[model samples]
Target: MLDFAIFAVTFVIILVGAVLYLYPCSRRASGIPGPNPADETDGNLQDIVNKGSLHEFLVGLHQEFGPVASFWFGGRPVVSLGSVETLRQHINPNRTTDSFETMLKSLLGYQSGMGGGAIETMMRKRMYESAIDTSLKKNFPLILKLVEEVVAKWESFPEGQHTPLCAHMLGLAMKTVTQLVLGLRFHDDAKVLGFRKNHDAIWSEIGKGFLDGSLEKSSSRKSQYETALSDMEAQLLSVVQEMRTQQESGTFIDSLLQSNLTERQIMEDSMVFTLAGCVITANLCIWAVHFLSTSELVQEKLYQELDQVLGSDPITLEKIPQLRYCQQVLSETVRTAKLTPLAARLQEVEGKVDQHVIPKETLVIYAMGVILQDANTWKAPYRFDPDRFEEEAAQKSFSLLGFSGKQACPELRFAYTVASILLAALVPRLRLRRLEGQVMEVKSALVATPKDDAWVRVVRRS
Candidate 1:
């Protein structure tokens, strides 16, 4: 039996060695993996695909291999392009066949059957829009009005000292997006209690399934998400019914109704708007405050921009455009924080990438976080320097992160509007300071979250 075991081990070792030997090594590039760009895989590479956590592995592999490297993920061809220009061309393919939906379909397991959700379709279209839609446009004041309620709560909290101002970012984001879309504030001493309960029950555990293969693996998790989504749908639909009865003379809902959109489309689109807006805004606010507090000089500079542009007046969407430095600060905040919140895709027939001829069906992905931080493109790639974006060229360089230029999301034109108003509202009334003894970094997930709670204390300016 011992002799048989020894022979079995020897046979396995030899087979593995033979497989590795057959695999091509760096061919085209100087420091990359795979054979030359000429070498193409003749067969499906499932081993590379199913390895899972495929992103982390590919990042490490790319670091060794250099730009334009290829790897396998889920029996599909995956290529990593580190340069910004090349990346821009990769995602904006001239076809509707490739998009965030392909990725969502993968995540939601949206196969041919099961009947897809309207919310998903609405989310995709909104994401594709270059700027805020005509419907959401009317809700400009409502967005800030909702946030003012959240800011009021923070003001009510005890004066001075350390506070978990961190958690409030999410709640603020939730309230702003919720009210903007549904015209309802869902957080308060009473409602916050419920929001927290529902939030924890649903979202807290949603990320855990990301580890063990599919998000569908946990029945409890699947149910929690479904329940949360369904509850949201019900809440929005009820609001729609109420709005229909009142028939507001002028409002976001009124505009939504006037459009030839279906009832189901309204609910789905609003939810999509909520998801799209809430998550990014909250994190940006927290990160901006955290970074600003850490540098008094930078804070002072931002204050100068704020006070000089529209002194003692509430920030309006019209005024936000002229605040260039403040805009730069916000842009720098996004760049430095590297939220890389989501990945984008396009179905370009894959050309030859390293050892593999990217088959037409293979999905192509770009790591926004890593791509944004490329040392070749960014000086002091890891440093937090707002001035880098102060110049036109430097600022233009960041268009890959969706600020301006060809791939720019039109919503970004207004994100500045929202971010500017929020910052202006607080800068005059509060002083933000980062907490001590905490490691500040980013949490890697579907979106980048501040790794630590990112706590700060706010002192109301007298």
Candidate 2:
């Protein structure tokens, strides 16, 4: 017993010593924002979109602390810009690659190997971009068929049955994104069962880590995240093999897999693309419906537009141009819902954004949600107004919605088309109603999702 105590004490001391010695970077006061005693009113902001509420808090700070307000969270220095013009000028074409990739590395368990240079990096990113272009043009119709199957099956559930609308939306989005990107399906009875096992382990571990930042300290997180990556990769690899066997021209994965890309790079790019696409697209759909339910005016207007454009006809790809109002409603939802409240960049050394000096390695977060609320760029910014997207001018210049021009999300181009087509096709066939007493909330992970299931009734429309 005495010897055991001695060993235990020594082990803890040594462990503490080692963690301090090996990962000294963790000790810094990285001002990554979250809940703090100093920031209480931000609870509403945090509630609206969790994680990094500091960006909103910064709005208050900028009011109180001036144009350049620097604050601390998680030992990081976070800087927020008050001016969009200044931000756009300083913003790079590529997102400033950050240490979050370290978490990806642990999750995916890929060796830290580097082979490709500028051409290779550009090729990989552009190819990923280009393949999305191809999938949007090629694979989405197949996804629409699957969604149609899901929705057609869905309409039979009775008027008040209250099916899991959130899950179904999420599922269709996931299936669409994965199949479109990889050109494979995971709906196989056995493969789906195993894929669920793998996907759950991956999501749960990362979820806990995001809330607690325990992944940085726990070997178990490192292992679980990695194992999930490996399993996902294995699944993707098999799909890639099938794609090749089918003599498919090339897919996003097939494109990267064929090139001189490392497994880590392929897995990283694929995972990010698929995960981001699935999440943002689905949540945006859910949020859009939520908005429509709350704003009957918006819903009726959109339905009117649908009625005028493609009356009682299925939303063919050709008619997307005609469904302009529906696109505006979705756009306003992105702005009001603020699905991605903040976009971040890491700067190690002090840098100048025009005149202001942001000290080095600062985590500069664009308060995207707050920015959307600015009266200058937006009219009646707080209200859920979709009309902003109605005119020829608004439609043409609606580039601020993340996927505009160069900064536009590659997935955005495809997501709305699929979502709108689904909406136009199904809304005409079904009547949707919000289930009584179901309050919608937001949870911010990689992207924001409904806090609880968005329970709804899908009755077949006459």
TM-score of each: 0.76, 0.77
Locate the minimum summed-lDDT window of 10 residues in model 1: 1-10
In candidate 2, how many clashes are counted?
Answer: 18
Which stretches of model 2 miss by more than 4 angstroms? 1-63, 66-68, 73-76, 89-118, 210-224, 241-246, 249-251, 255-264, 311-313, 347-351, 359-361, 391-398
Q: Write the per-residue lDDT of candidate 1 for residues 252-326, one digit (tens) a residue.
A: 444566555566656655544555455566667777778887877777788888889888777776777788878
C-alpha positional error of residue 90 in candidate 2 after TM-score superposition, expressed in Å? 2.9
lDDT of all the models against the reference?
0.55, 0.58
Q: What is the lDDT of residue 92 in candidate 2?
A: 42
Considering summed lDDT, which 10 consecutive residues are worst modelled in model 2? Answer: 1-10
Q: Name the top lDDT candidate.
A: 2
